[model samples]
Target: MHLPPPSEHTMVRTERVARRVFSRLNLALLLTGALAGCGGPMEPAPSALEPEGAQDVQAQALTYPSGSSQTVVSRRVVFRNGSGAYQAAAGFEHFRAAGAFDIALHNIRIAEVDAPATREALVLMSAGQKISSSGHSSGVTGQASNWDASCDSVSCPNVSLDGRSLAMKLRALGLFPSGKTYLSVVNDANFDHLFDSDTKQRIVNGFSNWLQAQVRPETRAIYLAGSSRGGCLMMRMAQALRANTALDGIDIYVSSFDGVCRNSQGELGTFDSKINNPVRPWGTFYGAWATNLTAQFPRRDRLHIFHVVGGQEVAPATGIRAFSGYAGSTPPSTGTNLDWGWYKQTWVKWQHKEIGNPYTDPSASDQAQAVAETVDAHLTWLDARLP
Candidate 1:
């Protein structure tokens, strides 16, 4: 079941010194833009198969701090398993309209994965993509399947998903929300560009706006997930939602994977020479905002956050040196590329970080299920904490 990498792109190993120097320059330029309060126009490089107008309908420029700005957006598209074509995740009526699930990916902090997640929408929503389709039959029950509505070779109204191992698990759990919204900015050069305070605000605003217009009153159990910097953003948004009067009456659960998140615990900075500064975002200079943001909530008990990490370290083949800030090689929405690096003494250590409590890193595979399991465990944890 080997799916070849994109013919145009390959994840080859990059030289350490060159990559670091570039990353430093990138990070510096980012900080400079942050301080200057003025940014030049951004160039939109296409990553998905569709044009911007097709991918995002309500396209508009979102202003950012430092005068920097780009078009931040929310989009929905569907991928049917075993089919190579993509369908609209839209026109499905309302938020809880069945047949699809709604999830939020946040990168509200100084840096986040919103860009990569959105850019890779084609790959993310590609029905043919391996991550979503690989060996999903193992999770099926009875002759009927969540992907029974095959769209390939036939005109069926329903969208065929990646069966139970992936999207099906979500649908069965009722976490898959309809009217899917993708949140991210264009010209996302990763790292520094990601630290746009203005764009973050706009994205958060978009979330609120959608809730006002689309979300059905009966919608319950919204699953909000983010990774790395996105994790910080998720927590920030979680705090807001908990206190938000508009979002009241709906249960919100958060799941963060290898995300630099915490109220005031855990260590920061890189582990070894192999690892350049880890994006332990929850406590970075900018991360303090997340802490303050989370604390402002009146009821912390209502918002439950789950932390999960499978293979909480850089891939052995890539090592820390093969790092890319959600670079082109990265797959969308999936948190694999931006996962945390091992905190060992050196690459010589070459050992995987100990799988954390409530999380078992099945190396690269099963991350989706791992996350679902983590959320289930968090619910249990929440129940225990409540009474």
Candidate 2:
């Protein structure tokens, strides 16, 4: 049966806050950031990259040099169905060569209309920004419809965008660009309808399944990040990794203000739950998704997860607690906490009590600073443990 829609109270409040934040952030970005030129409308689909006889493909080999500290390789991989070939565009900061190091970013797929263009664009934009700031070059890979497995699911009519398969594709790409990779995955849904049922399901399936393989030795140190639904996928992936022995080496760090998940009691748990009564659908969906993945490797101690949520944000507190319950207690506490006040306090201390109103402050600006600190703390912990 189809799930009920999210509550109006939560939706309305989220929209209101989002609009105000967007307006302010846009102004700030416009003033300080250089906007990328939007490419003309998507051109005709490029030819297929898949070989005629290949199916259930194997991962390609990508070896990093043994003593290579100066060079960091970055790659982007995309899996699409009926869309077109994946092409890598040059000239972005992420792809430019830097001193004593060749930092390359690759795109997994070319532009395809089947998925939400705006979401894809935003991901590309974010990747570009990250590359610019970090001085890394990136590339993209392409795959065709035959590669998608979820579209072949009984619930869906034909090969739809499968998060599981897409994850596999990314894993393959990571083999080559192995040093430190930033992977982004998005479902095939319109940006305006990101919260809809189908879109949510796609994200759940995509991320949960992908997390299964990403935590291996070949790719464990990669950083996980996303926004909105993408953020939700990242959280679920962290939870899944925590429960899987095969993923023990992976260190996950996520910041999602608008994602949802299920508590151990099968209750709806998300930031939106407080405002929206009967979060059953979201809970059930996420629970089912997590259960399926956890069952694949049921041991509790295999995965160690660390995440931060805005205390003011509805889901992080409840969701993290529920996830902690599912994961059971571990040494040093698998979950770390963060909220608006905590961030504000940290900001004020760092700035010598000069900043004001963390709650009403711009989310983008505040979150950027908050996430950096979170990542730094996580890295310190990881270095001591992994090194």
Candidate 3:
């Protein structure tokens, strides 16, 4: 208490010394903090630390109405050490898988909406006509031994084939657009007999009339797929449809798988040949008729005639060279008149019977992969072309 009464200058000098010591202590603390930060991890810049556009992320597994489920993740990215470098998380895989699924699902819904409300489709079988108990020439009726189409009622319109065929498989896979009523017509080896002059025009015309009656004002297009003799018969049926004035605006598409232009007499004819060595008139007529009808539709991709032939086709029973002639040698014979039909010689090393079967004949397992590929390609073609 007595020391406080000393001179004012002595008090001022003491205060200044205390202030200098406090400043030195503060500087020492700052240097120690900076050195510790350099030894440890540096704090990331706010912008780079968090992923861009990440907000309220809540992802879970999604289950569709069809009982299918998929795991979903919110897209995210992370940066390291305050640098711009980043790595994607599970969201990148989600983008590829979910993106494709969404696209395909969208395409299917769009197709269903765009298809005509009422339309007709046909799957003509390789079987020929059979004399029913009622004495009428009806197409064959029976279930296939394998997973192929079964014609419950032959020559009937809007009748569905119960079992699985190429077309039926496509429908099951949703390749064919919605609202289509499909029918499968069947026959046996006697199918070629209908091409005979004695019955060709009458039988074919009757079949054509039955089919034409099914087409109404609302019908937008006609799809015809056939194998073997049915493929050949489809040409004639198409001709009849072309002649009918009622179906002028309706488009027609034909798919012929291993068709042979053989007359009723079991003799082959060249395309547009009137020489008539075997005197098969229908053969010449069909080629010229197809050329004429296809000429009417000049629009590209409007009407399509597709012919697919198997390269390994040969006589199965006799093991002899047969059916190769139907493969076509030149442009006109290939049904390419003004780009009418697209012909393809497939690499599906299948014999005559196996090519049209629902699956490869069990004995021909070697060709199964090729057959599957061919079917997938055709399905893709139908998907792109169907309205």
Q: lDDT tens digits, residues 145-207, model 2?
A: 232232321112222222212123333322213223434433221111123444444433433
Question: What's model 3's lDDT at 208?
Answer: 65
The residue ranges of model 3 lying beyond 4 angstroms of the native Cα positions read 1-142, 146-164, 175-182, 187-190, 193-195, 263-301, 311-348, 362-364
How close to the true structure is residue 147 of candidate 1, measured as C-alpha lDDT?
31
Please write out the lDDT profile of model 3 over residues 1-387, one tens digit for every residue.
Answer: 355474643543454345335534654676567767687776554454331111111011011111111111111211112353332222122222222222211111000112233554533433322224321111111223321122221111122233234544444444333456444344232343333554445445545654565566666667665555555566557666766666777777666554544432332232332110111122221121111233322342435565544423233332111122222333233222122243332222234345455243536454444344334334434444554
Q: Give per-residue CA lDDT, model 1, range 1-387, as digits (tens).
A: 999764322321223234335645765786577757656655455555432221221111111111112212223323232464434333322222322222211111111112221121100111110112321111111011223233222122232222322223332322222223222211110111132454444444444343334345444434454434344444445665667666666566554433433222211211222222222222321111112222244565445555433323333332222111221332223222122121100001111221111123344454333333433333323233221
Compute the lDDT of residue 44 as modeled in candidate 3.
53
For all candidates in order, the CA lDDT equals 0.30, 0.28, 0.37
1 or 3: which has the higher lDDT?
3
Kindly indicate the candidate among 1 and 2 with the higher lDDT. Answer: 1
Best of the candidates, lDDT: 3
Q: Choose 1 or 3, whichever is better by TM-score.
A: 3
Q: Rate residue 339 of model 2 by lDDT.
A: 28
Clashing pairs in 3: 127-187, 127-188, 128-187, 128-188
lDDT of 1: 0.30
